[model samples]
Target: MSHPVVILGTGLAGFTLAREFRKLDKETPLVLVSRDHGGFYSKPMLSNALAGNKTPASLVMKDSDKMSAELGAATIHKGRTVAGIDTAARVIELDGGERIAYRDLVFAVGADPIRLPIEGDAADTVLSVNDLDDYGRFSERLDGVTSVAVLGAGLIGCEFANDLLSRGISPTVIDLAPRVLPRLLPDAASERLRSKLAEAGASFRFNVSVSRVDRAGAGLKLTLSDGSVLDAGLVLSAVGLRPRTGLAAEAGVRVNRGIVTDRLLSASAPHTHALGDCAEVDGHTLPYVMPIMQQARALAATLAGNATPVVYPPMPVIVKTPACPTVVCPPALDASGAWTVELTDDGCDARFHSGDGQLLGFALLGAATKQRQALVSQVPGLLV
Candidate 1:
């Protein structure tokens, strides 16, 4: 018998692809490998879990065994990382001296938190919420903590700050940029969100970067660029995520920003494909659930022997900060355009229009967020 269709990683990307494949072909040999507990859960809910009065265990939807049984696929929990891949032989070498053969392979390795190099014991004390396990650890440390210093003012950082506030914990957000959600929101919309968050009892440290984190007795002390220090009982790093492509790259797959793939989701190597956060499809890698779901369906058909090109419509990322209420469909990474702002007393809406007055993207906050679906329908397909 031929080797099974193997997928690496059990996150949203891997499980969604597995479910999609089973939808078309019920009996195809399928295998899923993951480093974590291999639970079914919405990763976005991690930040909001505490605010919803839920524990880490309560957040998980299903365990590895249940997920495998439901999807009719073999599950390998806590598999060793792929050391390398022999594309010519269709085999993957595990770090544990194990080899897995695959008739078709899908790389959904996902991403990891991007750690910043800094000095002092406080660096070791800083935590990140990237996965369920990480959230569990962070939640345990939240007990009896009064203040938190969150690094980065991006979407995740803002969401965490909001979550902390709802749990009666104060958070001071520090970002090198002048405004929050710099990549997603225009200046006017960002300002509106900043004001709303401020009213909600969140502090900001803009135009300042952390130089080092020193353990100051009972708390962590953050040294900023201006020779000032901020102390917090806990530190959360939400800077960014780095895609897991080292294995694919070592396997001789083309990697640029992420694992390179065509519209059909096939990598440079034969019978090997990549998707989700690990895939750079047509020069775009979306780390959101919307894009992962879109890619899963298209890749499933192609992997099941029916060739289909993945088509992505305009998908707006809804920031889960109920305090400020923001939604955004950021323009393409290299889009060249100027943003025009229309502000209201309780809200702001900014549109990213090209030089030709084409509506490319938009950011909506507060009452303006009601126009998300309407504005999204007017935008064109990204990364054609």
Candidate 2:
């Protein structure tokens, strides 16, 4: 009997594992399922779409049929979701009354963009750019809009602002935090970045919350808690992402912020694994390509009987804000240490050093980004 393996999701993690597994066990029966179109595209490309002068269609590298053919794997482009999983029987039930069995299963369901609850007809006007389909839909509405309001001044928000500015559309960013990218940058570094973007025509309103949003004639009027309103042609929400963990949780797979996995990417269930933005490894859910790729390799090896332990290296995220150029390896959220910032004329660098002066994290922006390699080398290994 051929060993059959099933992988959920068609994003980077799913595709990477399928390709890796094929290298070692080509004869194994592999089945891939996805809710979306299952086309292969870089997730990071969504942020730089406008700056790269590319449409959503142009960014697609391959569709499901092409990828399935190239990998020699069975692909189910079923829009129906995997409703439940029976780990004891090693079978999964789909929403469309389909049942599939697998010797090994991988979950890479990725994440969902968080949408805030606010009152307004304009609330429907605010959209988020998460997947390729979302990007295509968003690009279509940008043709006639002159000004945009971006909620959340973090990495994605900054990238979108830069992209909009590149297209001659100035975006005004609104964040509840006192500084931009509060999760990544230190106060000094964030200030420098804000200054740079401001020079590029990106206005910001910090320490403010959007009380409500409403349709104002041809544009949107966003009311703030401070009794002020800002008008814009459109609004984009980039307030971060929440991992899709409900399915795993319902199946009794341990879940925190994401599906809990061990060093080998194994979930609580036997012969079952999880990775990518959907997997919480050692309490860390990194929704980035690099960490997901690392998890894919280790999990693939484990599935192939190698029992490889996933080793997480120091992964510094390179921010895609071309206007101000930033890179950050933020300290873990619960870490006890704080960062000290150093600002220079050309850029900003902030070091997250422990009480004992041990470097734990760092954020570099503009000319200071050249320190990424050396700084990354100084931080301790994530797995260690």
Candidate 1 residue-wise lDDT at 331? 87
Residue-by-residue lDDT tens digits, candidate 1, 205-232: 9999888999887878899989899989
- Candidate 2 backbone clash number: 0
Write model 2 residue lDDT over 294-347, tens digit each, in one string: 888888888888998888788899888887898888887776787888888888
Clashes of 1: 0
- What is the TM-score of candidate 1? 0.96
User: lDDT for every model?
Assistant: 0.88, 0.87
Per-residue lDDT, model 2, residue 2, is 58
Point to the candidate with the largest TM-score.
Answer: 1
Candidate 2 residue-wise lDDT at 355? 88
